[model samples]
Target: MFIRIVKMGFNPENIDAFLENFEANKAKIRNFEGCQFLELYRDKNNTNQFFTYSYWEDEEALENYRNSNLFKGLWANTKLYFNQKPEAWSVNKIAEAQNKKPAL
Candidate 1:
């Protein structure tokens, strides 16, 4: 599985507008092919700072979604509110939780 995380810092006044866009499009994003999971998070100390954490089947699936019109629209709306460039990370899960379980 591929894990994708994007952290965005927005102007405090624009936070609600950005979240509205996310709420409106989150369902459609989650329904994309090869999408495993999706969620939005906020920094506890800074409400204007938010993040999205998603899981995908692979890089190809992510690329397809990134190139879709849905992404373009959502991203365009989100970017204008940003106070700084977004930070993103793509990761691979190298270990399973079950492997750390105590032996029977």
Candidate 2:
């Protein structure tokens, strides 16, 4: 799977507006083609900083979303609330530990 992480820093006064925009668009983002998972996180010490963690089937899926009108509209609204430029990363999982015990 391909993973995407985006970190955004919002102006304290504009945080609510950012949240409202995100809330309105999150479902559409999650339901987009090849999207496997979607989640949001906030910095422990900075309430105005947030991160989005999502999983896609592959890079092409991610690119398709980025090229879509949904992203264009959401990002246009979202960028207005940013305190600084957003940071993003695309990654691949190398390893993961299993939670369940194997058959003995």
Candidate 3:
């Protein structure tokens, strides 16, 4: 699986606008092809900073979304509210674990 994380810093005054836009598009984005999970995180110390954490089936899946019209439109509106240029990272998960009860 592939993971994509995007960090965005929005202008304090425009944070509300950003949230509104995100709210309108979150469902569509989560339902996009090859998307496994989607989450939004807010910086603990900075109310204006947020991150989007998502999981995709593969790099190709991510690229397809990036090239889609949905992304184009969402990003166009989102960039207008940015206080600083956004940063993104694409990574592969190396390990994960969950506790399980012993079989009887």
Candidate 4:
């Protein structure tokens, strides 16, 4: 699996617009082929700073998403609100551990 994290900083005045666009497109993004998980995070200290965390089946899957019309259009619209250049990282998933509850 592959993990992706995208960090974005938006103009304070454009935060609402960015959020509205995200709200409208999140479902489609999450449901896209090869996408296994998706989430959004905002910095506590900087309200205009955000991150998108997602898991993909593989690098090809992620590239496919980047090449799709969905992404092209979304990126074009999303870029309009940015205060600075966005940053992103794609990495191979190593491992995940979760706590389990014991029976009472």
- What C-alpha lDDT do the candidate models reach, one value each? 0.93, 0.93, 0.95, 0.95
Q: Which has the greatest TM-score?
A: 4
Query: TM per model?
Result: 0.90, 0.91, 0.92, 0.94
Clashing pairs in 1: none
lDDT of 2 by residue, 21-53 (tens): 888888999999989999989899999999999
Model 2, residue 71: C-alpha shift (Å): 0.3
Candidate 4 on 1-104: residue-level lDDT in tens? 88999999999999999999999999999999999999999999999899999999998889999999999999999999999999999887677799999989
Model 3 C-alpha lDDT per residue in residues 1-104, reported as the tens digit of each score = 88999999999999989999999999999999989999999999998999999999999888899999999999999999999999999988999898999999
Which residue runs of candidate 2 sit more than 4 Å off their true CA positions? 98-104
Cα displacement (angstroms), candidate 4, residue 34, comes to 0.8
Models sorted by lDDT, best on top: 4, 3, 2, 1
- Per-residue CA lDDT of model 1 for 1-104, tens digit only, reads 89999999999889989888888889999999989999999999888889999999999999999999999888988999999999999998898765576779
By the TM-score metric, which is better: model 2 or model 3?
Answer: 3
- Global lDDT of model 4: 0.95
Clashing pairs in 2: none
